[model samples]
Target chain A: DQQVKQNSPSLSVQEGRISILNCDYTNSMFDYFLWYKKYPAEGPTFLISISSIKDKNEDGRFTVFLNKSAKHLSLHIVPSQPGDSAVYFCAASARVVTGANNLFFGTGTRLTVIP
Target chain B: EAGVTQFPSHSVIEKGQTVTLRCDPISGHDNLYWYRRVMGKEIKFLLHFVKESKQDESGMPNNRFLAERTGGTYSTLKVQPAELEDSGVYFCASSPGTSGAGEQYFGPGTRLTVT
Candidate 1:
């Protein structure tokens, strides 16, 4: 079963506009969430993250909002640029009693920002 | 400092062959992880190592896949008698410590094709 899901397979936005990507999780035990951006043939790069304790986290042009009650999260990039076009993945991790951490990832959303 | 480094960027071999993928984590990072993505699928975690011991390996698919980390620096994943279904991109990531809040640095990934 896919615990994390990115419903949109692709998205397109104009440069300087806001790009929003959504993700959902079925498991309520997840306590930490992260977003990674990946280019073709390269590994995913960490972009931003939000903890379950907080409703939102912002860094530069990227902002992530979490709604625990809905088991959902969204990433927003304001003034999107062409360099922002890439595959974005959402991942979650639940606190383990044994002190080890592992992440569950979503099937990435491809975002294209037109120049 | 350099990010994670992976060797043998691409490999193609016949079925039933043995292949080994290597990863060198950051100089002082203590956490290591392995992940893989098959065609049109989300990236999935395979294992995690803390220092020299494997902290979690629940994501390992089968006995044919073996992972090792010597001296807690670099890691090697060996797939023996690889099956056609094993064709995928394997990624390696590392973090500083046990903090679930830490960011994970990823390698370029190794693409393996089994014919």
Candidate 2:
């Protein structure tokens, strides 16, 4: 069973525009959400995260928004650059429910920025 | 300051062959995790190790797979008689603290191909 889902397999945006990636979850036990960006040959890198208690979290040009009721979350990148083009994965952890802290990840979405 | 390191970035073996993958976590990180992503599927959790003990192995596929972490440092995952379905990218991640909601850093994945 896939607890987390990213319906969009790919997204394309022009450079300097806004790029938004969306993700959804079926498990209500998930209290923490994270976004990971991966290059072609590299592992997924930690990008941003948000806790269930907060609705939005922003760092530099990246921002993440979480909606507890909708069981949805999104990653927004402003002024998208060519370097930001890569695969983005959405992962969730149920810290309070399971102390093991294993993450459940979605099938990542590949993003391309048109220069 | 080095991130997690994985050995044998790519491997190809017959179905009945045995293969081992290694991962070295960041210094002082007590939480280590293994995850795999088969083609066209989401990244799935394999196991977790805290120090030299096995914290969780519920995600392990079968008895053919074994994981060990000795001296609370590096870890090794071995697959005997690896199956064709085992072809995928394996990722290793580590976090400094016990609560690993958003702090886990990952290494470049190991791609395994069993024909």
Candidate 3:
């Protein structure tokens, strides 16, 4: 079963606009969420994260909003640049419950930025 | 500081062949994890190691796969009598802290193809 899901397989946005990517999870035990950006032929790089206690977290042009009650999270990139075009993956973990701290990841959403 | 490094960026082997992949984590990082992503699927955890100890391996698929971190410096994963279903991109990640609060740094994955 897929605990984390990224419903959208792809997304497109114009440059300097806001790009929003959504993710949902069925597991209520997950308390920590993270987003990773991956370019072709490269590994997924950590972007930003949020804890279940907080509703939102921001880092520069990237912001992640979490709704625990809905078991959903979204990553927003304001003024998205062409460089932001890549595959974005949403991941979650139940850190407190598991000592291994393994992560469960979404299928990933490919983002394309138009100049 | 160097990031996590994976060997054999791409490998193609026939069925019944044995293949071994290696990962070298960042210096001073004690937490190492292995994850795999099959075609069009989400990344799945294979196992996790804290130094030289195996913390959790519940995600390991079968007996054909073996993982080891002998000196706590590097890890290796071996697949014996590879099957077509075992083809995927294998990724290694590492974090610095003992707790699960730190962000994981990933390595360029090794793509394994079983023909």
lDDT of 2: 0.94
Which is the winner by TM-score between candidate 1 and candidate 3?
Answer: 3
Q: Scored by CA lDDT, what does every candidate get?
A: 0.94, 0.94, 0.94
Give the number of the best model, judged by DockQ.
Answer: 3
Per residue, candidate 3 scores C-alpha lDDT tens digits across A4-112 of: 9999999999999999999999998998999999998788999999989899999999999999989999999998999999999999998866644899999999999
Q: For candidate 2, lDDT tens digit of each residue in B3-115?
A: 99999999999999999999999999988999999997999999999898899999999999999999999999999989999999999999887554555899999999999
TM-score of each: 0.97, 0.98, 0.98
Once fitted onto the true fold, the runs of candidate 1 whose alpha carbons sit more than 4 angstroms away are A96-98, B98-100
Candidate 1 residue lDDT tens string, B37-114 = 998899999999999999999999999999999999999999998999999999999999855575688999999999
Tell me the deviation in Å of residue B72 in model 1: 0.9
TM match of model 1 to true structure: 0.97
TM-score of chain B of each: 0.97, 0.95, 0.96
Which pairs, if any, clash in model 2?
Answer: none
Better of 2 and 3 by DockQ: 3
Worst 10 residues of 2 chain B by lDDT: B95-104
TM-score of 2: 0.98
Candidate 3, B25-64: lDDT as tens digits: 9999999999999998999999999999999999999999
Give the DockQ (2 decimals) of all models.
0.80, 0.81, 0.82
